[model samples]
Every structure is written in structure tokens, then in C-alpha cells.
Target: MPALLDIERGFAAALRTGDCTMAAELIAPAGVSAGDAITIYRNTFVSGAVKALKLSHPAVERLTGAEFFDSAASAFVAASPPSSGCLDDYGAEFAGFLRLYEPLLDLPYVAGVARVDWAVNLALHADDAKPLDPGEFDVAARIPPERLVLVPHPSLSLLRLYYPGDVIWRAVLERDESALAALELRGGPFFVLVWRNADGVQVGRVSEAGFAFLSALCAGRTFGESFDAAPSPELPVLLAECLAAGRFTDFREI
Candidate 1:
């Protein structure tokens, strides 16, 4: 008798690769053939994965159209199955897959779009935390500038893309033909900031300087160092905006 873990692995392998021989040996005889039973499991597994991908990357599906997106998603699922049981945690590598997918080579920006979509998905599901009070940094004031670390909100993320993916994604969400038509994809290597607030998730492009400051802080640079890294002279203004947006959850003295 095979160990339960071995049986589970065999079943997963059959679903993932469509080779049912090993898995079939473990199944008790029934009216349906072992191959037929395994086929049902395979279909269910693939369809569930495809649905999760579609949910996570809706803009990708809209851009590619249903048929093409399903084909591409199927290929991706076969190549990379979910490591975790949680469906929401799946498809992190899908943007990378789109980049290397031969059929999507002509649409170079699709991968960037997928990246933005994934970021939004992550923000929406991230753990909830209250924004730090404006005075929270005061404690750090007593600590030397070199040792203070600004901690980003658990749901905050920054994405830099070669295309205006956030704009494209918003247009898709709004279902506005005019907005879609007005988009000019030629101008950017856009820096987008994503964070979840009390209302909902927000996605917007940030200035190079703003992004620089935020990136430095996120990377654990000291408050003084992060301010110095800002590309624009308006570091104070940007810091205020970040606070208002609830991008930082707390600070720690390192």
C-alpha cells in the first residue's frame, strides 16, 4: 500500500501533467474507468486555477480576449501550479510568465499591466493595520537620525513599469471607452504607488522624487538618509502626502 503522501503526490502529478497511470493504481475500482475519473479531477484543477488567474489578472484577460487568455492561462497553470493551498496567494509569477510567453511577445506592455493588476490584488488582501499617527515619528526624533527606520504600511507597495499600466487598468475598471482611447502608452516608465486605506485600495502614479523617498524608506534607510535620497527638493511636501495617504504604519529605532 502506498503512503498517503505518495498517493496525494501521484494524484497531483496526474492532474498537473495528465498522466494518470500511477494515480489510477491507487483508486478503488468503480463503474467509471480510472482514466475517466482522473480526467474529471484534471479538468476541475485546471479550471479552478484558470479562474484564480483570471480574477487576479482581469485586465490581462480583457486585453487578450477570452479565448487567448484562457489558452495562455492554461499553459501557465501547467508550467507553474500554486505552491500554497490558498487561491488568493496564487499567480505571483504570472506577470513573469507573460513576459516570456511567445504569443504575447507582440504585446510587450501586457506583462506590465499584469504586474499592476497583481499589485492591486495583493493590496486588497493584505493584513489590515491602522495608519501611524503624525506624531508617531516624534519618538524617533529623540533617537539619532541614523538609527531610525520608517516602516511602511503592511499594504503599501511600489511598482515601476515601462507602460502606464495603472491608467490602462483604471480604464478597464471604469468601462470608459473615451478614457481608453485617450491613453497614450508611449510616454512612460511609470512609477505607481499602491496602498489600501479605510475606504479601499488606491493606485496612482507618483513623481520620481516621491518614489525615491518612499523606496528608500521601504528599504530600511534612516529617515535622514531617505530624505536625502529624494530626487526633488520638496521632500517635506512629499512626506506629508505620504502620511496623509497612510503609507506608513509605524517607525522603529534601529
Candidate 2:
């Protein structure tokens, strides 16, 4: 008799590759043949993974169409099965997969679109955090600038892409034909800010300087260092916008 670990390993391999020979040895014969049962499990696992990928990368599906998305997703699942049981954690490498997918080479921005979608999905599932009030940041202002580090909200993510992925994604999501028509595939070197709020996930474009500033803060750079990294005439305005948008959850003296 196979050990439980061996049985599980065989079952997983069969499900992942559609080859049930190893798993069949472990299964007790019943009404269904072991091979048939393994086939059923394989189909269920693949279908579930495909559905999860569609949800995680809706923009990619929108770009490729359901039929193409399903085909690509099947290949991806076969090559890289989910490591965790949680569906939400699945498809982390999908964007990278799309980058190398030969069928999608002509659509270079497809991978970038997938990346944006993944960011939004991640933001949706990020740990909940409260935004500090404008007054709260005042304390940090009083501290020695070199010792202060602005902490980003747990849900905040910065995405820098060379394609207009966010625009394409928004157009599809909003069902705006005109907006879709106006979008050019390589229309950007966009710096997008993604975060979740009371309403849901929000995505907005940010200037390069703003992106640098936020990224520095997130990396635990001191307030003075972060500001200096992206010093600009619009620095104050960008800071005000960050505060208004609740980008910072707190400030720490580090």
C-alpha cells in the first residue's frame, strides 16, 4: 500500500499532467475505473484554475477573448500548477508567462495588461489598513526629517509599464467603445498607482516623480531622502494628493 504522502504526490502529479498511471496504483477500484476518476479530477482542477486565472487577469481575457484565454490558461496550468490551495494566490506568474507566450508576441502589451490586473487583484486581497488623517502626518513633520519614514497603506501598489494597460483595462471594464477605440497599444510609459479603499480597488496614473517618491517611502527611505529622490516643482502638490488619497497609513521614526 502506498503511504498517504506518496498517494497525494501521485494524485497531484496525475491531476497536473493528465497521466494517471502512478495515481492509479494507489486508488482502490470501485464503480469508476481509477484512470477515469483521475481524468475527472484533472478536468476539475484545470477548469478551476482556468476560472481563477480569468478572474485574476480579466484584462488579459478581455484582450485575448475567452477562447484564446482558456487555451493559454490550460497550458499555463499544465506547466505551473498552483503551489497553494488558495485560488487567490494562484496565477502570480501568469504575467511572466504571457510575456513569453509565442501566440501573444504580436500583442506585446497583453503581458502588461495582465500585470495591471494582477495588481488590482492583489490590492483587493491585501491586509486592511486605516488611512492616517492629515493631522497625523503633522507629527512626522515635527520629527527629524532623516528619521521619518512614511509607511504606505497595505493595499498600495505601484506599477510602471510601457503600455497603456490601465486605459485599455478601464475601457473594457466600463464598456466604453469610444474609449477603447481611442487607446493606442503603446500609448504610454505609464506609472500607475493601485490601492483599495472603502469602495473597492482604485487605479490612477501618477507622474514619474510621484512614483519614485512613493516607492522610496515604501522602501523605508527617510522622508528627506525620498523627497530628494524626486524633487520637483510639483512635489508639494504631489504630497498633498498622496495625503488626500490616503496613500500613507502611518509614519514611523526609523
Candidate 3:
């Protein structure tokens, strides 16, 4: 019998390269020839990976069309491959791949959209916890910059894009809504926000300042520092709205 590592390596190669002969030798066989059975494995592998990619990048798939996106996703899988044991993490780098992918160079915003999608997926699976009560902030006249930590919800994802991908995403996703109409892709360097709530996936368009503010908090910056990075007359109001919207579910004084 082939060693487990060798068999696994050969299996990956055969699946990616479509060289079924080697793959056949590794798996258990029944009446079917090794090559024939290997084909089953290959098909299963590709289908599973592709489906996950589609789910993770629905907006990209919508914009690019199913066939193009599938082929590109297949090529991406063959190249970088997945390093994680979790299938959920399989397309973590897909955004980076789309950025360098030749056919997608014209669709620069697609990659940013992919990033947002992946973040949403991660956030949905994020740890469950009660969100902070907005009234808690009223108890403190001022939070110490060093000791204060703003907790953004684990499911909240902020994305910056060179095009209005968020707007496009909304139209494609909410097509069934009565309010949805024909959408023309906006020419933009836009920001997007995605978070999970009681209603499932929730997406919103945000300003560059909002993106910067949330992003800084995510990176562990103090509220004061994050606010300083993107100061605005309405920041206090904006922050309150985000909290009210469940952008951050909880906080701790770290």
C-alpha cells in the first residue's frame, strides 16, 4: 500500500492535473478499474470545490457568468490548492488569485467583491455572543484610549473596492425584491459592509471613512485612534448607528 502522504499527494496531483492513472492506484477499488473509479473521485472533488467557490463568491459568479467563473475557479484550484483541513477555508486566497488572473484583469472589482464574500462567510461562522448594549457607553464620560477596545461583531466585514461592487452585489442578490430595478454598475471606488443577522446575510454600502474606522477597530486600534484616522462631524452618530445595527455584538476593556 502507498504511504498515506504519498497517496494524498498523488491524489491531489491527479485530481488537479486530470492524470487519473496515479490517482486510481491510491484509492480502494471495487469491480471498476482504478482509472474509472478515480474519475469518480475527481468529479466529486471538483464539484465540491466549485460549489463552495460559487457560494463564497456569488457576486463574482453573477457578474462573470457561471461558465467563466467555474473555469477560472477550476484553474485557481489547480494552482494554489488548499492548505487547510477545512473546506470552508479553501477559497480564502481566491480574491488574490482573481486579482492576478489574466481573464479577470478587466474586472478588478471582482476580487474586492470576493474578499467581501469570504469575510462574510467567516463572520457567519464566527463565535456566538451577545452584542454590547449601546447604553453602556453612556455610563462612561470618556473611555481611556489605551484601555478601551471597541468590539465589532465577529460577523461584520468591511471591504474597499475600486468599483461599486457593493451596489452591483445588492442588485444581483436582491433581484426578487419589489424595490429592485435594473441596475447599472456604478463607476466607483466604493466601500462595502457585510454582516450576518437574524435575517441571514445583510449587506450595506458605506463611506471610505466608515470603512477606515471599522477596519482600524478590527485591527485592534483604540476607539480614539480609529476615530482620529477618519474624523467626521457625524462619526459619533455613525458609530452609534453601526452599533445599533449590530456591527459589533460585544466589547471588553483590554
Candidate 4:
């Protein structure tokens, strides 16, 4: 009989490739043949992953329809299995896969929609953090803007895309055909801001200036450096809104 490690490796390969030859060599057939058992294992494994993918990317599934989504997800599972043990950590690459997926090449916005789904899913699962208190903001207020570095809330993320992903995602989820119809698919690079609070996960579009300002802060830039990076005249109003939105957990003045 082969060693335990080698058998396990073979079993994993069989699960991925749908060939039981290596694992079958060691197994005696019972009521179910070794090949059949391996087949069951593979199907069960792939199906669970497909379901997880569907959950993480409901917009993608809704946009594509179950039949098509299942087929594409199955292919993705075969091509890219989960690396992390956590289900929440899976399917981060599905959006990229959809972009290159042959059948989806013409419908490129589908991938953008997947990105919105991924972003929102991530926000929903982010670690809990208290928003910066009004007092805290007041303390940081005394510091010169050049010396202030803001810590983003755990759930805040920026996803910039070539298509208006958030609009499409909302339109599809809400079944708002009029909004979808009015969308100019070619009018992109859209910047999407995703974050979570007591109200729940929020997804919305931000002007390029707002995205740049928030993006700079998220990257650990000081107010001065961030403004230099974005150089927007609306920087003051954007900063006030960021404070009101509770997008930060902390801040420090250097």
C-alpha cells in the first residue's frame, strides 16, 4: 500500500482532475466502485465550492443565470480551487476569471459586476471596529493636515473598474431595467466605495476626486500627501463627509 501522504496527494489530484487511477489503486471496491466513489467525492467537492462562489457572487450568478453561472463556476472551480480554508476567503479571483472566460469575453461588464459583488462581500465580512468618535476627530482636527494620517475602518475598500460595476450590480439586484437601460456602458472608469457600519454594508459610486482622496487615506497617506496625490478643490468637503461617514477607525498626528 502507498504511504498515507502519497495517497492523500493522489486523492487531491483525482478530485481536481476527475481521474481516480492513483487513489483507486489502494482502495478495494465495496458496494460502490472506487471510480464511482471518487466521482462522488469530486462532484461533492466542486458543488460545495460552486455554491460558495454563488453566495459570494450572487450578482454574477443573477446576471448570468444559474445554468450559465453554474457552468462557468464549475470551470472556475476546476481551474482555481480554494487556497484558504475559510469560505469567506474563497472566490476572490472569480471576477478576473470571468473577464478571461471565453464565453464571457463579449460581456466584459459581467466581470465588473462580479467585482462589486466581491467588494460588498468583503465589506460584510470585515472585522468589527468602532468608528472614529467625534471627540477623536476633534483631537485630530488640531493637527496640521500635513501631519495627519487616518486609519481606515476595517470594512472600507476601494474598487476602481473599467465599467460602472456598482450601477449594474444594483440595477440587476433590484430588477430595475430602466436604470440598466439608461447606463452608458462605455462611460467608465468608475470608482466604487464599499464599507460597513451599523446600518450594514454600503456600496456607492464616488467622484474621481472623492475616490482619490479616500484612496490616498486608505494607503496611509497624510492629508497633505493625499491631497497632493489627488489635488482636488473639493478636498475639504470630501474630508468632512469622510468624517461624517465613519470611514476611519483612528487617526494620528505626526
Which candidate's TM-score is highest?
Answer: 4
Deviating ranges (above 4 Å) for candidate 4:
none
- Most lDDT-accurate candidate: 4
TM-score of each: 0.94, 0.95, 0.84, 0.96
Q: After aligning candidate 1 to the native by TM-score, how far in Å is the CA of 196 from where it should be? A: 0.2
Supply candidate 3's per-residue lDDT for 104. 83
lDDT of 4 by residue, 100-197 (tens): 99999999899999999998889989999998875678888888989999999998989889988899899999999999999998878888888998
**Ranking by lDDT, best first?**
4, 1, 2, 3
lDDT of 3 by residue, 1-254 (tens): 77889988987788778888767766676788877777788888888888888888887888789999999999887887667767777798898999999998886777876787787777667667566677876643265766677777778778777766666566666664433355345666777888876666677876778778888988888877888888877777778887777777655566
Superior by lDDT: candidate 3 or candidate 4: 4
Q: Model 2 segments beyond 4 Å from truth?
A: none
Global Cα lDDT for candidate 2: 0.87
Candidate 4 residue 236 Cα shift, in angstroms, is: 1.6
lDDT minimum window of 10 residues, candidate 2:
180-189
Write candidate 2's Cα lDDT for 1-254 as tens digits.
Answer: 76889879889889887888888988898999999988987889899999999999987897789999999999999889888888998998999999899999988888888988999999988898888788877777899989998888888888899888888888877788999888777656899999987778889988899888878888889988988888878877887788888877888887
- Per-residue error for 75 in candidate 4, Å, reads 1.0
Each candidate: how many clashes?
Answer: 0, 0, 3, 0
Residue range 1-254, candidate 1, lDDT tens digits: 78889989999889999999988999899999999999998999999999999999998888789899999999999999988899999999999999999998988889988998899889989998989877866676688877888888888889988888888888877787898899899987789999999879999778888788889999999988887786577777777787888988888888
Give the Cα lDDT of each candidate. 0.88, 0.87, 0.76, 0.89
TM accuracy, model 4: 0.96
Question: What clash pairs does model 4 have?
Answer: none
In candidate 1, residue 65 scores what lDDT? 93
